[model samples]
Target: MGTSTRQLNIGFIGFGSFAQFLAKTMTKQGHLIRATSRSDYSAHLGDNFIRDMDEFMGLEHDVILICTSIVSVSEVVKSIPFHCLKKPTLFADVLSVKEHPRQLLLQEVPEDSDLVCTHPMFGPESGKDGWKGLNFMYERVRVRDEDICSSFLNIFEYEGCKMIEMTCEEHDRLAAQSQFVTHTIGRILSEMQLTNTQINTKGFEKLIQVKESAAKDSFDLYSGLFIHNRFAKQQMKNLESALERVKGLLEAKM
Candidate 1:
């Protein structure tokens, strides 16, 4: 990793909406951003978009950021021609689940390359205004080049993100407790198909926001959160048990 925040050739493997959002910030910070993905995003990326994977790898990016969904990450990484990588680069991910991507990248990427498993906890909606104080969690799994890693991290630091350095396992455990549970309840409320009523309390209004926010994301994303993170299955079970206990208390009152 580079010690200073110099302009880097950052290439994105999946140029989705989330990737585009991050690219906007990095570009503003003077990093050259280029991308290749399943779809043609040339119109959105302008000259920065490279349509061919072979060509994308040949660009010799200082950092290769993987922005694929949890479910598709394995497939996407497997399909990549790593041999085409022009040089040893830092490979980072912005997946919601940490350990899964961490394991995948370690197994797939070249031995010489570095790996950083990251999860930018906020998204396009929460970060629409700016990334100030937003949680940016990362684990420097295999960092041979500290200067380059620090430089890439400086991009988020420049945006006022609360940089959190923790192990991928710890991240998954905490995420299952907080993020997974929140999404589970949001999905439940969405299933109820909540609608605005004549009389709405502040708490109820917040629930509506949760439902709307969760609904805005694809079912694939929600499922990926639940499916990819091993800890999430236990969290789902806990949620069910807690709901049952609440129902029992209510039944006793009745």
Candidate 2:
């Protein structure tokens, strides 16, 4: 973590749920933030601009944190002035998938700044429970500034998250199994929509509880991950094969 939290002025690009949550968390840590707004070119998340991302990006900061959805990540990256970003600007994103956006960010960020792709496996809405199960997945490739990578890792580490590093491609391919498959299955569970009235039992109630929790995220986000991720498409094919094999086994059992 930066010993001088007061010196960490950050520019953020999006104003979604996780962005707002992370802004509050970083603000509590005493760092100033500027953000871009759909309305204004620059604005502060607090009084000066208060949720205007442009003002945040205009300020001098240690990092530019973009907490946008996976689909919007690249567009926001391209819109920002990469050349003007201060040296050692640690650019980090909290998007779910990595490879595509990570490549896009790398192309824009100069050698002086660091571009990191991170997937925070835990949501900020853990409330009182805190984040022990949460994992901060990251990658610090052969970029211009390695210290920026160190600084980025420090931010998540200080926030009580477990930091795991891998290449962006590896991260994306792996997430298909880790994140996409589970999410796809969870969506399947939610779509089933069976209730206790249909089958009165604690087991059924418990299943709904788990299923709803997994499916609690927006449908758009789910579609983005399941549809955009290349590995996810393959996994679904694998799933179809499994189901077919299982059906054959059941028929043979007869």
Over all chains combined, what TM-score does candidate 1 have? 0.96
**What are the clashing pairs of model 1?**
1-145, 1-147, 1-148, 1-149, 2-147, 2-148
- Highest-TM-score candidate: 1
lDDT of each: 0.91, 0.70
Q: Write the per-residue lDDT of candidate 2 for residues 1-254, one digit (tens) a residue.
A: 22432336776677666776777766776667666656442333445344433445556777777777776666777777665544567778778888777777778877667677788887756633654546888876545655655655665666677778888778889989877877777777788875557655887677776677677788878887876677788988998899999999999999
TM-scores for the candidates: 0.96, 0.83
Clashes of each: 6, 15
Task: Give stretches of model 1 more than 4 Å off.
Answer: 1-4
lDDT of 1 by residue, 81-186 (tens): 9989878999999999998989888899999999998889898889999988999999999999998898899888888889999999999999999988888888
What stretches of model 2 exceed 4 Å from their correct place?
1-7, 39-44, 48-56, 83-88, 142-148, 197-206
Top lDDT: which candidate number? 1
